[model samples]
Target: MTGSPTHEPWEVYALKYTRNDKPRRMDVMLGEGGSTDPMPMDYFIWVLCRGSRTVLVDLGFHAQVAARRNRVLLRTPLEALATMDLHPANIDDIVITHLHFDHAGGIDQFPDTPIHLQASEMAFATGACMAMPAIGGFYEEDDVKELVRKLFRGQLTLHEGDDVLEPGLSVHWIGGHTGGTQVIRVWTRRGWLVLASDASHYFVNVLQRRPFMWTYNVGDHLLGFERLLALADSTDHLIPGHDPLVMEQYPPPCADLQGIVARLDADPLFSVHDRIPVQAGR
Candidate 1:
C-alpha cells in the first residue's frame, strides 16, 4: 500500500528528546533579553507518515551528547522514543535539517534508516568550516564523521535544490542558520505544515523578524524565514525547530507505548495572530 491516500488524513508524531535549559535560555534571549520567563526547552523527533514508509524530521539529541558536552541529559532521545514505543530501527527515513550536533546526533542510532540532507550541508561539513575553530563550535566532528560514513554506505541521500519527496511532501533549500539548512513542508489536516527546523529555532525569530545569532548569512537567514512563512498556511502551522511553546500548543500523542508522541491527525487550535507577517526586509 502507498500508505494513506491523498484524501486520507496524514499523521505526524513529535517524539520528545532532550527538554531542558539551554533552549530555555535561548528563548529568553529572543523574547525578553534574558529576563525571567516560564519558557522551557522542548526538543522532538517529528515523525511523519505511516505504513510502508515512515519519515522523521530531525532526530532529537542522543543521551551521550550531554555528557560529551559536559552537561546533563535532562531528556534523553532514546527514553523519549520509548515513551511512544518507537525503536531506532522503526524509522525508515530521516530528513536532517542541518548537521548541528543536537539535531543530527541521534542518527547513528538508526543504523538502517535512509537520511536526507541538502547537498550544501555536506560541502559545509567537509569544507574549510570544519577546520576553522570558530565555525567548528557549532558542529561535532565525531558526529559528522559518522554521518559521512553513512553517506558512503548509501544510507544518506543528498538533495541539491527544491524537490518533492512524495506528493504533498517537499524539501526546500533555505540555508541561513547554516550553509545547508532546509525546511520540510507537508500537507496536513490543518493545512500546510512547515517544519522550520533550525531555519528559525524560536517562534520569536519569526515574530520579531530577527535572525538568530548563529547564522552564517544573516541575509539568507532572514530570507529563509520569509520563504518558510510563505509556504506555511499560517504562522501556527510553521513549527519552529526548538520552541517550548510547541509542546503546549499541539495535541498530545495517541495512547500506546509512545503516547507522548504527538498525533498529527488531530487539528491544532490555531490563532489568527499566528499568521506570518509580511517579510520585513523583503
Candidate 2:
C-alpha cells in the first residue's frame, strides 16, 4: 500500500489448519483487563498466488504435534493446500515467518523447496536463549534441526532485513513474538496487504497496542503493530496470523471453501476494526 507496484498484484489466501477453542484471554494479551473467558485461536498458513507462481507462508503443524499440543487439528497443511490444487511442487518458495513449531514444524514436508527466513530468527532459535524453558518451549527441536539441515543442504534463503522475494512480494522483519518474526507484504488488488504472522495474533493485540502474553521483546512486539499499520492498505487489509475473525471477515474462494480458506485479496465482508471490542476507559 505504500508504493505503486510494477507488476500485477497477487491473490492471497489464508488456509486454516488447526485451532484451540479453550485458550483464555490471559493466554493471548498482557494487561489488567485480560479475562479467563475463552479467547479462541486458529492456526493458518497463507498462500500468495499469481498465474503459475505460488508463495507459501508458514507450514501448519502435523497431527502428531497437534495432539501433543492439545490443538484440534482440522487438517494438515498439505490437505489444506490440496483444496486449492496446490502441492509442494507448485510452490515457488516457502517463507518461514519464524521457527515456532506451528509455523515451521512441517519444514520436512517440502524438503526440496527453498525456504525464506530471517537470519536473526535462526540464531534466536538455536542460540543460548533456548536454554530457558519459557523461551525454548515454543520451538520444536526436530523443526529447528530440520532448518539447520536445510541450511546445509543449500535450500534455505536468509534475509538480513526487509527484502523482496519477487516484484510486488516482499518480507519485512518485525520481531516481537520472537527474535526473528517477520511479516509478508504482497501487492494486491486492494493495495498492499500484510500477512501479520504472530506480530499481532489477534486484532485486539494491534488495535489496542497490547502485547501477546508470549513475547520475546515486549517493546519490539508493540512496535511491530505500528509497522504493520504503515504497511497495510488499512486495518481491514491486515490479516492477523491466527484470528478466527479472518475466516469471518474475508469470504472463501467459493461456497465449498467456507470456513476453511479465505480470499484475502477481496474486500472484507465488513470493516474488521468494527469487530474489535472498545475497551473500558478507552
Candidate 3:
C-alpha cells in the first residue's frame, strides 16, 4: 500500500448517491442536442487508499443544502462513508475537485484534513467572475465562504498546474467545467486510473464528444477528455465524475453494500459502447 506507478495499485472506490430527480431539457447538463429522453445523472464522491494513506475526493452536498436546492439527498457523503467504516477523521487528505456546491459542500466534515486543489479555482470563486450569473450561478455563496474561512485558518493546501500528492497519486489542473477544475490520477491494481471529477461528468461527455453546458472553457473541456484518455492506462480505467454507469459496470467492494461502493482495483466488466463514429482529436 506504500506507492505504485506500474504495479500494486491503490484501492479506489466510488461512493455513489441516488439523485432521484427529473432532468430539465436545455439545462446546462445537456449536450448541444443532448437526448430528450430523460438524462440520467447521479452523484458520487470517490475514496482512495493505498495502505495507510486514505484520500477522499469531492465531499458531496449536505442534506440541508439538498433540501434547499430541492434535490433529493439519500445520504450525506460522510454518512455513506460510515457505511464502509471510513469516518471523516480517518481521511488523511481531502481533494476538492472544484469549488462547485455539490463537489465542495462538506468543508466542515473533514476538520483539519489538509485540502488539495488548484490555486486558480480559489481565485475564480472569489474574483469578479462571480458577478457574472452565467459563471457564478452553479456555486453556492455559503460554500465559497467556508472555503475562504479554511484558507484563513491555514488548513488548505493549494496546488498550481499539476502536482503529485504521493508516489502513486497525483492531480492535474484540467480547467474545463470550472476555470480551476482538476482530475485525480492514481495507480490501482488494474493500472493507472483517473477520477475525472467534473472534467467529464458522464462517459458520453468524452466518448461521444458531447460537452456539459456549464463549462468555463469549451476548448478545455474537450481537451480534458482527451487528457483523461491519455493519462489513464486505458479508456476503461478512467472514471467519470457523475455517470450512473459506473455503479452498473463495476461490482461493489463488498457483497453487503451492493451498488453503493465500486472497486477500482480490477478490470471493468462492461464493454464501452462505441457509438460515436469519429475518433477523438488529440
lDDT of 3 at 75: 84
Clashes of each: 2, 1, 1
Model 1 CA deviation exceeding 4 Å by range: 1-9, 22-39, 255-260, 270-282
Local distance difference test, per candidate?
Answer: 0.74, 0.89, 0.82
Model 3: lDDT of residue 156: 85
lDDT of 3 by residue, 1-282 (tens): 223455456899999765654664666454464445666788998899877889999988988888888888778888889878999889998999998888998788776888887999999898898999988877889888888777888878889889988878889999979989999989877778899988988777787677788898988888888888888877788788888888887889779888788887667777556422334664
lDDT of 2 by residue, 57-76 (tens): 99988778888987778789
Best by lDDT: 2
TM-score of 3: 0.92
Instruction: Please give the lDDT score for candidate 1.
Output: 0.74
Whichever of 2 and 3 has more TM-score, that candidate is 2
Segments in model 3 whose C-alpha atoms lie over 4 Å from true places: 1-8, 24-31, 274-278
**Tens digits of per-residue lDDT for model 1 on 1-282?**
113336543577676665656433443332246545555566676878745566778876666667877656646777776666667777778899988888888766888888899999989988898877768787877778878889899888899978888877889999988899989888767677788888877777876677767778877887887898888876777788777666656668654533356664466645525543443544
Please rank every candidate by lDDT, starting with the best. Answer: 2, 3, 1
Error of 2 at 18 (Å): 1.3
